[model samples]
Target: MDNIYIYMLIALAFLAVADLVVGVSNDAVNFLNSAIGSKAISFKTIMIVASLGVALGALSSSGMMEVARKGIFNPGEFMFDEIMIIFTAVMITDILLLDFFNTLGLPTSTTVSIVFELLGASVCIAILKISADDSQSLLHLGEYINNSKALEIILGILLSVVIAFSIGAIIQFFARLLLSFNFQNKPSWYGAIFSGIAVSSILYFILVKGVKNATFMPDTLKDLVSSSPFQVIGVSFLLFTVISYLIIKFTKNNIYTIIIIIGTFALAVAFAGNDLVNFIGVPIAAFNSYEAWSASGVLPSNYAMVALNQPVGTKPILLLIAGLIMVLTLWFSSKAKAVVKTSVDLSRQDNVKERFEPNFLSRSIVRLSMTASEKFNSLLTPGSKRFIDKQFAKPVQALKTKSEDMPAFDLVRAAVNLMVASILISLATSMKLPLSTTYVTFMVAMGTSLADRAWGSESAVYRVAGVLNVIGGWFFTALSAFVAAAIMAIVLYYGRVYALTGLLILAIVLLIKNYLSHKKQSREQKEADSLERSESSSTQGVIIESAKNISNVVKRGNKIYSSAINGLATQDLKALKKNKKNITKLSNEIDDLRDNIFYFIKNLEEPSLAASNFYINILSFLQDMAQSLDYISSVSYKHIHNNHKKLKFTQIKELQEIDAVMETLFGDIKSAFASNSFTEIGTILAEKKSIINLVTEKIQKQVERTRSEESSPKNTTLYFSMLLETKDLLNATMNLLEEYHSAHDEKVAPARLPGSADPSLEEE
Candidate 1:
């Protein structure tokens, strides 16, 4: 029995390390998003600063471990064995929940997960204790739980979301008004003041509020900070203001960049100090419980976990090891980058590819906002409104910059994001609230973007949808964490060692599966022969770029057409389902290409205005082909999915023959486009009549079969639908070839008509 406890301890040690890796992956975005979004400094520099903050913050995190030990539940109420079960359950649930969110690239609160997991597991154990005792009843459950602290932590975290967003928005609106979009041309003193306030706020919260809880802080300094925080604030503000002014006056360096660098470090420190407990606190508490049990010389079931109720200091070495793991994860984890990208994309100042789609709620919100804006503007004087418009007007340079070089937002917004998020998170840490870093940072970024008008009419709906999706996921995290941890506690309580072995195996399998799935998805995105947009400015450049897209479309469209025929003939439902997905993806790629037509035209050289016509025609033909294929795939899949009868043998054979001929034509078209041999397109055009006739013949045969030998009305309908769509599909493919062939002819023809051989037709 004692040996099993030792094994549990070993398992927990590993879980703690694993939890740190996953927790950091989700939380890295909290500190890194602002600097990365603004492009304030080199990424290497940001990481170095953040890494240092994490190292120091981990050392200070010793005080936070109390939350996991006794903050969520009354630990003295549980025997050592029961306490172990609760701890084990919480660790398993926390790691899995955080990893799941990370894999989805959505930032969720690690603080919320850890707190709820502890609450759930302990509550489960408490219920068992009450049920087994004759005197103890349902009313006695509160004695086993720290309901007051649990409620406070939950309420604090929820309240922080609203507070962070409001403060961020108000500060940003004023900051933008003060600096305007042309802040770079403003007087040096203007920037110095902004930088001074931003940097000073970060320092005060991180040093006074955050560091006052550090294990290594001297008593005198903590006392000084606690007793005279206002004095510290005033002095720091004055000192940083002078320093900022000197830097601006003496050098060409941007002061906002300096603030972002310092702010990143401050937030990183606060994250580690507040969130480290979410990762390792449970395991450390478990270790302490085991020590107490062993030394008592009593059976584990009989020994109470009284030691957990008192304060216990965490070993510095353990904190250091956990910090090292987090720093490394911050530097290397691809998931961390993905989570950061989500926040940055949502808050970007200009449009890029939106990762989410608009929903009804988002649409309604945008409409209401527009209505309110109109009403608000009616209340403003004309002069005031004009002044506000001028202040918010973005510079022309912001519009012309290349996408890869453009920052997500200006440095001012980034500074505000960092300053607000760091202050809020550090303040929570000071009060021992364990407020969610993810929640505070993410909402602050969103709020700043909203205030800066980054979410313009073109992007407002999609951005709102993305925000709502993420918020929905957070609520899911809380409920799922509570339920899962409770269930795990029950299993561990009764099944003991066998249950532990099964769960460990299950966790290993799930982690491996998620990693491989993410890797495969990344590889597919890179290697897929998807359609691409034309970025060419000249006619010749457009021809080359657009030809590549045409070739890819032809190649993919061929496979999808063929798959539909084959899957239908065999009634292979799985293959048909996959074929539907393939066709839809191809169709969406074409749509994306069409969406870039505005930019394509804008980028065209004056001499290449004709190229726009050719490009648009090519896209239209490609869309036609995709629409045909999409219809075919959809109807085919629907037929098989409904368990409708397969087509008759003759009908199947005729469709297969059409598929073969269509495949040959598509192969020829693909080859012509791929090699830039527009001459071959002429040959493909010649066979267009034959291919269309073949599809017509299939339609005719299906009609005859339907009229005479068709026994099932459903089969007749499906066969006729496939035949007709195949005919449309052939026409679209042939039209694309014809269009390409004609464009080639126009390219190679003499600049003047053949009649220009006459001297009068020639230019003087």
Candidate 2:
């Protein structure tokens, strides 16, 4: 009996570890995405922080454990075996459910699953207790049903969603306002001080209050610490404050990216520490009870341990170890992210930066809001589009960029989450209600994601509605778990002959199904790879043939460069415009050709077509540079329109230099095309370095002189316009040049066209 008990305890320990790993891995997606999506911190940093959080959450989770132990059905009413059956059913079901969701990358609530599973198991146990020797039952089933913690859990979930949504919106609104002001006036010390105070207060309350029971400190240590809780808190607060201040001061000149990273990590740690037990608490509780009964040589009871007297034993230590395991899991997750990057369709992510064009609803709202403002302004004069643009549109544009639009709401939501979680957890502790942190926090994030319109217009409202429906579905989860556990218990009790054997068979079947599914997926993937390769090879051949045609066009164009340069330098607007038109036509042809190449590359079936596509992209970029040169030449002609012969000596010098550079680039392009050799392109590209530097310096001087002279409005506008055109032209040229140089360095060989020699075959 002693040995059996010892083995059960060991098994329970292992189960606890398994729960920790699964729970943390699933929950990780909740907070991890925000940090990664924002590019605010590295995966390694988040993992470390999350690990610490899990450790702390597990260690301090005694308060929640007590709630779980006593708030469900009366465990004393059932015999020892019944209790063991219910617990075992709940644990197995909960683990299977959560791990399944995690594998699908769906963010389900572990807390909801566990609570429901326990409810199901407990309900089954209750029904059996009522039916078996009712006269000796500790409590009636009616009384248990009416007074279970299910109601409280339901209410908590509902209230958390509402409160979290409201607070997240309000906080984000104000935070955006502050951010806008800061952008206009640089981040002031006052703003930093206020933000720090607010963040610190929220962090302390949530981490300290929410995690009170989950701490690693033993009773003795806790008693010692609590005797002077205020003093301890005060000293810790002071120490952190000093450190934070120094960090802020040191990073004042740099962006506060490091601080944000550190804060995010700390938050992740806290989340792990507080949430891990939600996943594994029941299994640990059941295992411990099973061990105690097996040791006492008595039939196991269905009765749950009393709330206050529940044994924590080494569970907190086990939880801390679980946290460490999560860090390693996070490392694996990062590697997986990198491996999938190329294949993953990032269209949704790209949509994040798409311009916010107003739909009918938004346009109506904007029109309505501006009505009053427009009427007031109209009293002075009739409103023009310029008025609307200046007062509202421009400011909004600037604010949108500074705030990063709705994504800025993520930080606000996180902050409010900590505050709300602390208060709710504290209330639950005081009132002895069983609330789930996982359900509350995740629902809150979901709500904020909706409110901020992060899901974009098409899906935002529907997703929000779906999330609410899911919350309702959580009740079903609890009901199902309770029912499943009860049924399993009944079968185990009355149909004992094949109970264990049936369960083993069921497990084996599930394992086999999973294995077959994986194999099928692998085979499909391989087939897809083979098809892709065949398609890519054909596409590569077409792109290489297209490149040869483009190269010939480029070589022909180079012959006309000297004549174009003379027209560009002579301030002959008519002649320059004609030359520009010819260049533009060539550029358009090249662009069309490049687009065809890209389209072909994309449709290629081969897996290695990505490399081929890269080479084509480089060629396309070079074409863009030729077009930009034409635009610059056009701008130069326009600038000297009125005073052709009186063109500024400085302007003339700049044009001559630009002309010389273009001539040299054209020669290089011609040489590369003729010899099918791109090796010297990189050095030729680097030759632009001095010219770019000179142009930038000249523009700066011109801008400064104009500002100092208090030039006329027309002069100022003209000066700035010309300067901007120069910059744009320079950038476009450099972009193409860089692409060419990079492609040359990569040494990607284009596939042989029809009637062409294979470059590889001809080598050496």
Tens-digit per-residue lDDT, 292-406, candidate 1? 8898999888888889887887888888899999999999988888889999999999887788999999999999989998999999999999988888999875654344456
- C-alpha displacement of 531 in model 2, angstroms? 13
Give a tens-digit lDDT track for model 2, residues 1-764.
Answer: 24433443454455455565556656665445444444445556655665555455545544235434555666555555565566656655665565554443345566777767667776766766666664746456655443546777778767766665566545544444444323324444533543454445444544444454543446764564446545655665566556555655675532234434444444455556556556556656666566566555544443333321454544445655665666566555422232122111111121222222335554454456358645865665445445433322123232212211223333433443443444444445445555565555555555444333344544333343444444545565566666666666676667543664475356446545644664554464344211111122343343334344445554545534444445545656677666666566556556544534433444545575555655566555556556555655565556556453443455446545755665666666556544555455555667777767766776776677666764455434444454465556556655655655554445555533324344642332
Candidate lDDT (C-alpha), each? 0.84, 0.51
Highest lDDT: give the candidate number: 1
Count of clashes in candidate 1: 0
Roughly what TM-score does model 1 have, to 2 decimal places?
0.93
TM per candidate: 0.93, 0.56
Model 1 misses residue 442 by how many Å? 0.8
